[model samples]
Target: MVDDNKFKALVNKYVELSDQIAEVGAELVALRKKKDAMGELVMQVMQQGDIQVLELTEQGGKLIRRESKRTEALKKEHILDELMLLTGNDATRAQASLEKIHNKRTLVVKDALSRKR
Candidate 1:
């Protein structure tokens, strides 16, 4: 009868160890899945950041081009006004026309700059 009790106790101990091992295996699998998901999220965020940087660079280039064009237009307007005054056929009319053109160009340039900001 004592031998029987000892044998049963040994079997119970073996069963308990098996259960603990199974629980640890399940926990390891869960940890692996969470790690994989986190890796994927990091990759997605990096891709989005790259896209945003590219867009910002393109916008900067466009703004530079627009500013250059505006400068050229303003210079041309100034030169034409000076020439018109020197020629002296109808100074008042020429000045008025030049003023109108300059005003329109200035508004367009201001609008573009504002949009960029």
Candidate 2:
């Protein structure tokens, strides 16, 4: 003899926990927004003041942030031609090669809520 009351109570508790999870997720999103804003502010201040490292209070850690300015990049449109020129116009017997080697593969998984239409 199974109790209907216990089963219903279990379902109610599950719904309550699901709602709590959503609330916590929202809080996390809000916290991330504030954190990103603070980071941008700190970077702006440092760049404007021509500063590198900013020392904080005794309890706080020092923040060392800098903008990386890329000086040059290999042109992809001229890669084969560039390789051809370097190889003395011989690709089959060329010692140099224009190659892009990927070291690893990454897999991404996303979780989203879908409503039935």
Candidate 3:
């Protein structure tokens, strides 16, 4: 039956979406932990009685940048996961739905970052 086939397809997509959500959730948690650790380390360095000028080494700068980028990537992945879960009921519509979600998430992050200054 065509209806049965459609139902099966929907179920499969739902399962895949669930798995993606779990993966993204784990990634988000790890990203948060990493960001927190970096923040703590920076705080500890600042709290030291004698702040060494060498603390701001090139390597440290690179590490900070890399961590920032990782956080952004995790956020993007989370948005994608959410999009997939929401659109999983209809395979034909999923791609457009995901693109919209991606654009929205990008704008949201951009706006939030801009407000920090």
Candidate 4:
């Protein structure tokens, strides 16, 4: 009887925490959208004003404008194109190579909770 009560309590706590996390997750997504929009606006302002750095005297901080490089993830089409090129434009060979690579890659599985509506 005691064990059953304890198990029920743990499950209840887990459900409550999961609910709180989901709510916060939603708020974070909304906040990120707003922040991204504001960031674009700030970038435009900085560009127009020809300002690279803005100092906040009260906040004891400064915002610095900088450029960053981002690399795009490799897609299947890109891989296929490259493989076909390497294989003398042989589609079948390229596909076989792609399949071989995919087969050799490791796969992992883990348990997760799915929220019910």
Please tell me which predicted candidate would have the highest TM-score against the true structure.
4
Return whichever of 3 and 4 wins on lDDT. Answer: 4
Between candidates 3 and 4, the TM-score winner = 4
**What are the per-residue Cα lDDT tens digits for candidate 3 across 1-117?**
469889999877877777787799999999999999987787577557444333457656432222233343456556556666787755446667666665675443443211111
Candidate 1 segments whose C-alpha is farther than 4 A from its true place: 43-117
lDDT of 4 by residue, 12-109 (tens): 99889999999999999999999999999999999999999999899999989998999998788899999999999999999999999878878999
Residue-wise C-alpha lDDT for candidate 2, range 14-113, written one tens digit per residue: 7777888889999999999999999999899988898899888886989898667975765544666766787788875332344431223355799975
Q: Could you estimate the TM-score for every candidate?
A: 0.31, 0.45, 0.36, 0.87
Clashing pairs in 1: none
Ranking the candidates on TM-score from highest down gives 4, 2, 3, 1
Off by over 4 Å in 4: none
* Poorest stretch of ten by lDDT in candidate 4: 108-117
Better of 1 and 3 by lDDT: 3
Better of 1 and 2 by lDDT: 2
What order do candidates take by lDDT, descending?
4, 2, 3, 1
Give residue 61's lDDT in candidate 2 (0 to 100). Answer: 88
> How far out, in Å, is residue 26 in model 1?
1.7
Worst 10 residues of 2 by lDDT: 95-104
